[model samples]
Target: MREIVIGGAQMGPIQKADTREEVVDRMIALLQQAKGAGCDLVVFPELCLTTFFPRWYMEDQAEVDQWFEREMPNAATAPLFAAAREAQIAISFGYAELTPEGRHFNTSILTDRDGNIVGKYRKTHLPGHSEFDHDRAFQHLEKRYFEPGDTGFQVWRNMDAIMGMCICNDRRWPETYRVMGLQGVELVMLGYNTPSVNSQDSVEGLEKRLYHSELSMTSAAYQNATWVVGVAKAGDEDGHPLMGGSMIVDPNGYVMARAETEGDELIVHACDMDACSFGKSTIFDFARHRRIEHYGLICSQTGVVLPD
Candidate 1:
C-alpha cells in the first residue's frame, strides 16, 4: 500500500496588523505539531500568510503591492521552509505572488518530503469583482488585485502519487477537478478563506455556506476517484468571519477526518493511494466511459446560449 499520512493544518485568521514573521511563526508551530503526529505531508489554507486582503479596496499601487511576495522563500518565509526541511516533511500552502513583470496571482505550491518544491498552481476561478461596488456588504476586489491564472490545470508525480493543487473558488468548479482527473491524479490539495456569510444574500448563513463547501469537495472526490485535502484559514479576521470546515475525503467521498472549530487545528489521516484503483478502473474509467466528441460546447462556449 502506498500510504501517506497527511495533515490538514487549519489556520486561524491573520489580522492585517500581523507581520509575515509572526505568521510564519504560527505555521512553524503547526509544522512541529504535524511532525509529532507523524504526518508525511501538511496542507495550509489559501492566502495563508496574510489576512484576506481582497475584502478591502485600495487604489494606491504601492499599498496593494505590499500584500504580495515578489519571491517565494523570501526573507519572511525562509524559516518555515527550513523547519519543514529539518523535519523531513512535505508541505503545501497558498500565498499572493507578485511577478517581476508586475503581474499578480493567487498561487499555491507543493513540496516533496525533503522540502523541495515539486509543483505550483495558480488559482484560475477568481471570485468577486474588480471594481468597488456600493451594493456589496463588503468589497471582494480579487479581480482588481489579480490577473486570472494563465497556468491551466496540471498535475505532478510526488510522494509516490500523482498529485494536483487548486485554490479557494476553484474547488467549486467541476472543470477544475475534471481536468486533473483526466490526468490520472490520485491526490488533490486545496485551501480556502471563504466568508461565513454570503455578501449578496443576507439569508444565507454559516451552516449553509459550510454545507456547500463540503458538497463541492465530496462530490468531486467521488466523481474523480481521488483523495482530496481541503484546509481553511478560519475564524474572524478583524470583524469579518471566515468559515472552517477543513476535511479529508477518501476516494469514495467519505470524510475521514474534520476540524470541529474555526481555529488553528490539524486533522490527520493515513490514506492509501492505491485505494483509488477500484473506482478509477471500474466506475470512473475515463477511457471506457467519457465521450469527448459530444462535449465540444464545453470548450467552444464560455456562457449559456439559448436554443433557437
Candidate 2:
C-alpha cells in the first residue's frame, strides 16, 4: 500500500495587525519543515491568514475586507505558492475568501506539488446567529459575516488515497464526516479556530472544545475506518483564548499524533493506506455493513413514544 507523510501545521493566534505577507511567511516556514521531514501534503489552520475577527462586532466594510484574501495566489501569498512549487510539495490551507462575485466563504484549498489548484471546500455548518446577542459574553458571528456554503461535502482522489476536506465547525457534526465517509474516503482533513470560552452556551468552553475535537475525529475515523487530521489555530487571539488540541487519529480510533503545548507546531505521521483496506473489509464495509435501506424510519413518525 502507498503511504504518505502528512503534517498538521498548528498555528497560534493571528492578529489584524499582522500583514498578509507575514502570515504567509509563517505558512511557508511550516511547508519547509514538512519538506525536511519528507512530507508530501501539509495542512494549515483555519483562517491562518488573519485573526478570529468574528469575536467582536464589526460593521465597517473596509475593516472586514482587510481580514479576507481576495485572491489565492495574489502578491501577498505568491511567495508561499512559489516556495511550494520550488519544493515540489502539496499543501491544504484554510482562510476567509472574498470572491470576485462578492460572496464571502470560509474555504479550504488543495494545491498540487507544482502549485496548481486541485480543489476547494467551503464550510458547510455555519454556526451562531447573524443578529447580535446582548447577553452573551462573546459573539460567534460566523453566520453574521458569512453565508452558508454551496458546495456539499466532497472526497477527492489524491496521492493514491481518497481524501476529503472540511473546516472549523463542520467537524463537530457527524453528518459532515459521514457524507464524505460514504464516498470511501481514506483520509479526511480539517482546520478550526475554536475558542476556549463558550459565549452563549452553558457548557465549559475549554473542556467541550477538547472533547469535541478528539471525540469527533476519533469517532469519524473509527466508524468510517479512515484517517482524520484535525488542525487548530490555537492560543490567545485578540485576548480570546483558543483550545490547542490539534491531532491525527487513525482507523482504530487511536490518536496517532497530537500537539504538545500549542504555538507553531507540526505533527507528522506515516499513514499506511493499507490499514484502511483491512478496516473497510470489516466493520466499515459500506457494501455489506451499512444499512441505508432501513434509515428512513429513524425520523419516521411513530405512534408510540420512546421508552424511558
Candidate 3:
C-alpha cells in the first residue's frame, strides 16, 4: 500500500507584530509534533509567515517588500528546513515570494523528507482587486501586490505519491484540480486564508463562506479521486477573522480529519494512494470518460449567455 500519513497543521493568527522567525519557530513545533505522531508530511497554511498583510493598503514599497522572502533557505527560514530534515518529515508551506528579478508572487513550496525542495507553485487565480475598494469593509489587494503566477499546474513524484500543490484562492477553482488530475496526481496539498466576510459583496454571510470552502474542496477530492489536505491560517489577524475549517478528505470525498478550533492544531490521517486507482482507472478516467469532441466551447468562450 502506498500510504502517506499527512498532518494538516492549521496555524492560529499571526499578529501584525509577529516576525518571520517567530512564525518559523511555530512551524518547527508543528513539524516536531507531526513527527511524534508518525506523520510523513505536514502541510501548513498560505502566508504562514506573517499576518494577513493584504488587508491594509500600503503606500511604502519597501514596507511591502519586507513581507516577501527573497530566498527559500535564507537565514530566516533555514531552521524549519533543518528541523524537517532532522525529523525526516516532508513539509509544504506558503509565503510571499520575491524573485531575483524583483517580481512578487503568492507562492508555496514542497520539501522532500530530507528537506530538499521538490516543487514550487505560484498561485494562478489571484483573488481581489488591484485598486483599493472603498465600498468594502477592508481591502483585499492581492492583485495589486502579486503578479499572476507564471507557473501552471504541475505535479511532483516524491515521498511515494504523485503530489500537487495550490494556494489560497486557487483552491476555489475547479480548473486547478483538473489540470493536476489530468497529470495523474494522487494527492493535492493546498493552503488558504479565507476571510469570513466577502470583501466584494458585503451582503454575503459567513455560513455560505464556510460551506462554499468545504464544498469546493470535497468536490475536488471526490471528482479527481485524490486525497486533499487543505490547511488554513485561521483566527483573527489584525481584526480580520479568517475561516478555520482545515481538513483532510479521502478519495471518496469523506472528511477523515479536521481542525476544531481556530488555533494552532494538527489534523492527521493516513492516506492510501491506491484509493485513487479505482476512480482513475474506471469511472473518472480522463482517457475513457472524457469526451472532448463537443466540449470545445468550454475553452473557446469566455462567458455564456442564455435566452432572456
Candidate 4:
C-alpha cells in the first residue's frame, strides 16, 4: 500500500525569551511521542525554533541576525537531529536561515528516516510588509527581515514517494501546489504561524482564520490529488496569538486527523501514497487535462489587467 504513518507536531508558542536549546528539547519530546505512536515521519511548524520574530521590527542588524541560523544542525539544533537519527524517524521543520553571503530566508528542511537532510525549501510567498505599518494592529515585518525565496517549488523522491514542501503564506497560493503537482508529487508538507486574527481586518476572528487555512490546504490537496500535512505553531506568543488548525489531509481531501488544541500536540495518520493514483490518473492528469497555451497570462502578469 506504500503506507506512511505521519505525525503533525503542532507547537503552542515560543516566546522571544526562549532559547534554541529549550526549543530543541521540546521538539525532541515530540519526536519521542511520535516514535511511541509509530510515526515514520514528523512535521513541525514554520519558524519552529523560535517566536515569530517577523512580528517585531528591529533596527539593529546584529539584533536581527541573532534570530537566524548561519548553518543547519549547528550547535543549538544538533541534538534534535541526533534524537531523530536515534529514533530512526524522518522529520521536517522550519527556521530562519542566514546564508554565509549575508542573505536571509524563511526556510524549511526535510530529513530522511536516518536523519539525513534530503531537501530544503525557502519560503517564496512572504506575507506582511517590510516597513512599519501604522495601520496594522501589530507589526509583521517579514519583508524587512527575509528576502523572497529564490528556490522555486521543487519535489524530491523520498520515503518511496514524490514529496514536496512550502511554508506559511505559500500554502495560500495555488501556484505553490500546482508547480509541485505538475511534478507528480504524492505528498506535500507545509507549516505556518498564522495570527488568530487578521491584522488588517479586525472583524475577522479566530474561527474564520482557521477556516481559511483549512480551506486552502484541503482545496489544494483535492486539486492536486496529493496527501498534505500542515502543522502550526499556535497559541499566544507573548501576547500575540497564533491560530492552530494543524491537520493531515488525504489525497481525496479528507481530514484524516487534526490537532484538538493549540498546544504541543501531535496528530498522526496512516496514509497510503498509492491512494493518489486514482485522481492523478483520472481528473487531475496534467498531461491530459492542462491547456498551457491559454495559461500564459499566469506567468506573464503579476497584477490584474482590465479590459480595454
Candidate 5:
C-alpha cells in the first residue's frame, strides 16, 4: 500500500504591497507546518507569489513583466526550495513564468524531495478578457497578460504515485482529468484563485461559486478514480473577495479534509493508493467498460450542429 501524507496549504490574500520575501516566508511557514504533520507533499495555490495581478489592466509590458518570475531559484524563492529539501518533502506550487523569449505563461512546477524539478505545467485553459472592459466590477485580463498554454495535459510518475496538474478553470473541464485519467493518474494537484462574485453573471453569488468548485472537483475525482488536491489563495485581494474552499477529495469523491477559513491554513490527509484500484478495476475501468468507437465524434468534430 503506497500511502502518501498530503498537505493542502491554502493561502490568504496577497495584497499589492506585499513583497516577494514576505510571501516566501508565508510559504515556508506552511512548509514547516506540513513537515510537522509528517506530510510527504504540499500543494500551494496558483499565482501564489503576488496578488492576482490580472485583476488590473496594464498597458505597459514592462509593468506586467514585474509579476513574472525570471527563474525558479531566484533570490526570493530559493528559501522555499531549500525548505522542501531540508524537510525532504515534495512540493507543487504555481507562479507567473516569463520565458527567455519574452513569452509569458501561468505555470506550475513540481519539485522532488531533493529540490529538483520533476515537471512543469503551463495552464492551458485561460479565462477572462484580454482587453479592458469597463462593464465589469473588476478587470480580469488574464487573456491579455498570458498566452494559452502550449503544453498538453501531461502526467508524471513521482513520489510513488502517478500525479497530474491543472490550474484554475482547468478543473471545470472533464477533458482535463480524462486525459490524465487515461494515463493512469492516481493523484492530481491543482491550485486556484477564484473570486466570490462572477463578473459575467450578476445572478451568480458566492454560494453558487463555492458549490460549483466542490461539485467539479468531487465529480472529477470519482469519474477519474483519482485523488484530487485543490488549494486556494483565498480572502479579499485588493478589495476583491476571493473564495476559500480548499479541499482534498479521495478516490470515492469524498472530501477528506477542507479549510474552513479564508486564510493561511493547512489540511493534511493520508491517501492510500490502493483506494484507486477498486474504481479502476470496476465501473471506471476504461479498458474494460469504455467503448471509444462510439465516441469518435468527440474528436472528429469541433462543434455540434443543432436542428432549428
Candidate 6:
C-alpha cells in the first residue's frame, strides 16, 4: 500500500478590493505551512483568489470578466506554481475561468508535484438562479455568471493515486462522486465558497447549512471509500458571510481533521491508500453490486407509491 500526505487549507475572507497578488501571498503562506508539515499535495478553496463575486448583480460583461482569469501561471500567480515546485508538492485549486474559446466556467486545476498542469475540471452542476430575486435574503447567481461546466465529472491518475476534482457545490451531489468512483478514484479534492446564509425558499433550512455541508462530504467519502479534502474560503467577504467548514474525511465516514473557524489554517493528515480496501471490497464494490441498467428512469421517477 502507498502512503501520501495531504494538507487542507481553510482560507479567510477576500475583500472585494483585494488584489490577485494579495491572495497569491496568502496561498504561498499556506503552501509554506504545508511544506512544514511535509505534505505531498494541498487543496485550496473555490474561487480562492477573490471575493465570492457572483453574489453581486453585475450587468456589464467587462466588469464580470475582471473576476475571471484567462491564463494559468500568469504574471500574478506564477509564484504559487514556483513555490510548489520548490516545495515538491502537487496542488488542486479552484478559480473562476474565462476560457480562450469565449466561455466562462468555474474551474479547478490539478498541478503535479513537478508543477505541471495535469487536469482541469469545470463545474457542471450549477446551482442558484441567474436573475436576482429580492424576496430571498441573498442571491446565489452562480448559474447566471458561470456557464455550466463542460468537463463533466472526471478522475485522472496523478501522483500514483487516482485523483478527482470538483468545485464548491458539486460535492453536494452523490453522482459527482459516483461518476469518478467508477474510474477507481482513491481521492477527491474540492474547494468551496459556501455562504452561511441559506438561500433556500424554506426558512428552516438556513440553520442546516453546516449539517448539510458535513453530511454531503461524509456520504461522498463513505460511498466511494475514498479520501475527501474539502476546503473553504470563509468569513465575511465584502459584507457577505461565507461558511467555513473545511474538513478532511477518511473512508470510514469519519472526519480526521476539520477547521472550526473562518481563518487561514492548515490541517495535515497522513493517508494510507490501503485503508479503503475493506470498504471497497465490500459495500462499494461496483463491479459486483452495481445495477446501472435499471437507472433509466432516474430522473423520471421521484418516489415509489404502494397501494393501501
lDDT per residue for candidate 2 within 1-308, as digits (tens), equals 68888899999878768888888888988889999999888889888888888887788878777777888978988899999889888888888899999998999998878898888999989888777789888888898888788889888887788889999889878878788878988889999998887887756768776987799889989988889999999888778888889998898889999998768999999898778887788877888877878887644853567779
Q: How does each model score on lDDT?
A: 0.96, 0.86, 0.92, 0.96, 0.95, 0.89
Q: Give candidate 2's error at residue 189 in angstroms.
A: 0.5
Q: Which ten residues in a row have the lowest lDDT in candidate 1?
A: 111-120
For candidate 6, the per-residue lDDT at 141 reads: 88
Compute each candidate's TM-score over C-alphas: 0.99, 0.94, 0.97, 0.99, 0.98, 0.95
After superposition, candidate 6 runs with Cα above 4 Å error: 201-207, 299-308
Please state the error at residue 166 of candidate 5 in Å: 0.4
Residue 64, candidate 1: alpha-carbon lDDT: 97
- Model 4: pairs clashing at backbone N, Cα or C within 3 Å: none
Tens digits of lDDT, candidate 6, 1-308: 77889999889999999999999999999999999999999999999988999899999999999999999978989999999999999998989899899799999999999999999999988888989888878888898899988888788888888889988889888989988888888899999998888766546453588789989999899999999999999999878888888999998879999997899988899888778788899989999999978986665675785679
Model 4 stretches with alpha carbons more than 4 Å out? none
How far is each candidate from the true structure, as Cα RMSD in Å?
Answer: 0.6, 2.7, 1.3, 0.6, 1.1, 2.3
Clashes of each: 0, 0, 0, 0, 0, 0
Candidate 2: where is the Cα deviation over 4 Å? 201-205, 297-308
Flag the better candidate by TM-score, 3 or 6. 3
Model 4, C-alpha of 271: deviation from truth (Å): 0.9
Say what the RMSD of model 3 is: 1.3
Candidate 3: misplaced stretches above 4 Å? 305-308
lDDT of 4: 0.96
- lDDT digits (tens) for residues 46-125 of candidate 5: 99999999998899999999999999979999999999999999999999999999899999999888999998999998
Candidate number that wins on TM-score, 5 or 6? 5
Error in Å for residue 104 of model 5: 0.8
Pairs that clash in candidate 1 = none
lDDT for predicted candidate 3 compared with the true structure: 0.92
